[model samples]
Target: MADPHERNGENERKPDSTDDANLSARLKSLDARISQASAQRAEAEPRPRSKTDSSAIGQAFRYSAEFVSGVIAGGIVGWLVDRLFGISPWGLIICLILGFCAGMLNLLRASGTIKPARYDDKK
Candidate 1:
């Protein structure tokens, strides 16, 4: 005679093909939604700008500040060094020259007179 538990187990078993098809359809739907979300995110993100993006007026103001600060700092240092070392006129004269050079250097750097180094593809 057939056992009652064996008969119940056969009745409870579900078809494997239906489960596989359902899972495949759910996965495909999820993949499509992910692709759409990614595209939207890309469109919402901001693009990077170049370093030399300032207007002419802004550039001029920056250069002016750089030049003035460099000259004042250099001159003060030179004067202090001269006074501290007891070099009177000689210290003052040397410091003035150094200050002028520093001012010019600052102006050149601000105006991009010196070219930036180029990166090589090697390495």
Candidate 2:
């Protein structure tokens, strides 16, 4: 039985020294070109802003926190009033309404829709 590679002379072929040198030169050229391209791209691109710059997501989170904190504070105060005055539902309900108003007011002020009370006090 004859081997197929032997019949085709595939196993007898060897890489030449010149072929190795040529391949090495091509690889170096490719690496240099790649590095040059990367440098140019870095120079062309704009630098990112610093962390102190507030993004849209940060502003949204701040606004939501302001509104939520107001609501939560109102709920706590209402609960306390109910507990202290021995009123079962009225105190809680009234306080909850007030809390919702406070939350809305806070949101308005934060959004610049309504001015701060201090502005009026100055006048």
Candidate 3:
């Protein structure tokens, strides 16, 4: 059986500092090449996003949820008011219109179409 610890006569030479220095130079050269290729790739123009890349479907769901939540909240309030005041259809109708407006406003706010209010100091 061959001994694992046995070194061949040619391989028994002492480790040389020149070999270590050469190895370090080679490693630095490889690192520089890798960094150059990486920078070039980063500078390259990106391809247009497909559906999976952009995920517009998730955004659509979020917008729809925001709008629907607003409407549902308004509707609930309107229903409560109708039950409280004995106003049958008029209250419900007015509340529904208000809810739709609220939902549209919510959607606009969410989409950045509506500007947010900024408070300034009165000094």
Winning model by TM-score? 2
lDDT of each: 0.78, 0.83, 0.80
- lDDT string for model 2 (66-122, tens) is 888888888888889989999978888888888888888888887778898577664
Q: How close is every model to the real structure, measured as TM-score?
A: 0.47, 0.52, 0.51
Where model 1 places Cα greater than 4 Å from the true spot, the runs are: 1-53, 116-123
Say what the RMSD of model 1 is. Answer: 13.1
lDDT score, candidate 1, position 40: 98
Residue 62, candidate 2: Cα error in Å is 1.1
Cα lDDT of model 1 by residue, 23-96, tens digit:
99999999999999999999999975545746778878888887787777777887898789988778777777
